[model samples]
Target: MTLPSGKWRLGFDIGGTFTDFVLHEGTTGALTLHKRLTTPQDPSEAALAGLDEILAMQGIGPGDLSEIIHGTTLVTNAVIERTGARTGLIATEGFGDILEMGTEQRYDIYDLFLPFPEPLVPRDLRLEVPERIDASGRVLAGLDEAALERAGAELVGAGCEAVAIAFLHSYANPAHERRAAAILRSAFPDLAVSVSSDVVAGIGEYRRTATAAANAYVQPLMHRYLGRIETALAARGFAGALRLMHSAGGLIPLETARDFPVRLLESGPAGGALATGLFGRAAGLSDMISFDMGGTTAKAALIEDGQAAIAPEIEAARVRRFTRGSGLPIRTPVIEMIEIGAGGGSIAAIDEVGLLKVGPRSAGSDPGPACYGLGGTEPTVTDAALVLGYYDPGFFLGGRMALDAGAARRAVARVADPLGLSVEEAALGIHKVVVENMAAAARVHIVERGRDPRDFAMVGFGGAGPAHAVAVARALGI
Candidate 1:
């Protein structure tokens, strides 16, 4: 966890569409920036590639770096896309359904057909074992070691990569949970285990269980992913400390990050908010708003008196998009912000009402936007921007990659024909809809906090933020 004495420090943020880098020289205070298309298959590949390119630009070797601060959307994307490892949950007897039951509170009370996010672990994988700890930290029913072993065996046989143990009142005693975890690890050496007492250590059953389950879900993935980055860096003679950004806008050691990947749900956004606070203060502004729009999502946060607020909990994979109670709850500290699935690669389409809509779905870096000429045929916000002459087809990515205007037009035509509008008109509609969406969300976020949009300066950053910042600001009357 200690940084070596070196001249350079590196910071990088990995978003859905791109991975961005910042290299700073300690003595000279010079900064170099670089961006690369994110490799969705393995995000570490993009990170390593960008690191090499940036270091090469300055003729500096990896040994020159004293530390590397990384912020990524890995855990967040995995939860949202349901791409994490196959995980099993072990809860107290008759309480195995706590993850599904949630808080039993509706996010939207008026809607009769409201949908809830499905539990990450299916019913078949969530097994109950005989164990109970009373509220006073006393063992009411002794741990059933045999039943625990059987449940672990079943989950391992079912190909589970990780397991979560959440006994009733584990926060009070934690003895049964620790014993169960030790037994499971002894039986399955390769399995990743997360106990509620180690992950959340809280009173609420649903939140504690869900948080532990989430930690287990992403544990194996984070381990493999971090290993790749470390090995790649070490191969190039890097011996510096590697720290990860937490959701609360602070850095944590690599080991802590590995054990609690759920704490990194908003790591990238937290980085943006932190940077916004620093830059806003440098500009002598005490109150400012941060607008960061990347490839897959847009985030807005309010910084008051040079500080970003930290929330006690965060929700993810919301079934109803921005709606509060429609997502999985994870009990972890996070920088408070409003995030929406509206970004450069956000897909554009005609909804059931025949109205043009954008987002919640994205053309990620695998195929990217239609304009990327990377096999994507869907019309996205990036495609619309290119169709509306907002980008130079031949100079995109600084001419390292070229865009296909014709492909963008064809993609936009799909929705245009159905809506009886020209391609250009459809593109404009797409842009306007996205701008309005961001502005509306930002407005709500600001106003709800008893702050007026006009009172704070808006500082926008990110690949797509600058393009739409003015429009969003105008819409907000800021």
Candidate 2:
């Protein structure tokens, strides 16, 4: 399987809200854009369907395909929703509760009821083997063979199809982790095992171990998803190899993805940055911010001098929207961005103080906004956009999904009357609130990095980003 000589490179980004397809013809430098409703049930199905439709429209066959670059939020969703396989963690004795203990830093030091994200692996599912590896990567206590056997048996008995083995300081010394993995493999040859040292070599024990655990948690799902995609592509007469875009905005072979599934956590956002980078260059902008508001979340990244900012560590599934140390920290190369639940489908309601509040909870595409007529009675950011004139009810998604403005008004009215504001004012307030939320997040992220928002131009994409960019920029005082 190889790429064709032609300049036909296809880039597909399967976002939480929409599946975007871009066909770039090397010959003419011409681009064709296609957007389709995402099929979360099987995201690859939407990709395939979108691919076929675009190929048909361009009158090109599979033979004309040079390369296909794809990205999705499948791994992120799996981890955030806790919908991955029943997984287990294997650690050195006395350190089995590392993940549970975490850094022990409170994001809200003064708040009494500070909530924490649940550990990916439960305590009972976290098995400890009789082994000790010091911070210097030296084995102070050798692995107890009998204890390993018993732990493996217990994990297997607990129905752990996948297990993560993260020994202390394994990044510096992997001997103990390697030995434990060997023992587990010998005992349960079919079980999937992930080691922290190999996945993330960064310092910070909790983040490294958490990253590895998250990887193991989603490994089986990624394997099945990628395999299914390969099969579907082969059946479609696309004989070329399939490459997945990683969170770092580079294409990695399927083998790499299968082994380090966690790297794809921010894959979808990476593609958006790549797209934004290309657009920025074309538009003669060197420094810019990429704002992507999809269905499930809103992602923002800062791009300076035609390069997207990248961070080596980021938290996932944060309990608090803007709080640091409030989520599982993963040590991986990812485009630095802040994600908030302020997407088009973000639910809007009134807080306890009778003040209108926008979301960190989304309606998703299943029921969608009340205007979608998909049985969703909740008022969403989309509904607010419809009422605020930012979205033309008849021209949304190029008129693919007809919206009911009346429904949106009614949904907004449910919360508007209590706030003593008209439906239009309430909808506008919702839009303002969401935009400010994104702007505030960007400001904090940029300032914390010792940069200024004014130094970056905002490059907006996704369904709602373009609509809210101006307001968000104004709110940021840019």
Most accurate candidate by lDDT: 1
Off by over 4 Å in 2: 1-4
Write the residue-wise lDDT of candidate 2 on 1-478 in tens digits. Answer: 3334865778888877678888988878999888887887888888888899888878886666868888988889888889998889988888899998998888888999989999999999998878777777777888888887888889889999899988777887888788888888998997888989889986878888899899999998999888888888777787665688999889898999999999999999898887788888999998788888888788888788899878897788888867888888988999888874388888998998887788878887777789888788889999988888778888776776688999999999988888888999989889888887788888888898788888777777788788888888888777
Candidate 2 lands at a TM-score of 0.94
Enumerate residue pairs that collide in model 1: none
The lDDT per prediction is 0.91, 0.85
| Cα-based TM-score, every candidate | 0.97, 0.94
Model 1 misplaced regions, further than 4 Å? 1-4
RMSD of each: 2.1, 2.3
For residues 294-394, could you state the per-residue lDDT of candidate 1 as single tens digits?
99989999999999999989988988888878899999999999884499999998899989999888998879998888899999999999999998989
Model 1, residue 468: distance off in Å is: 0.4
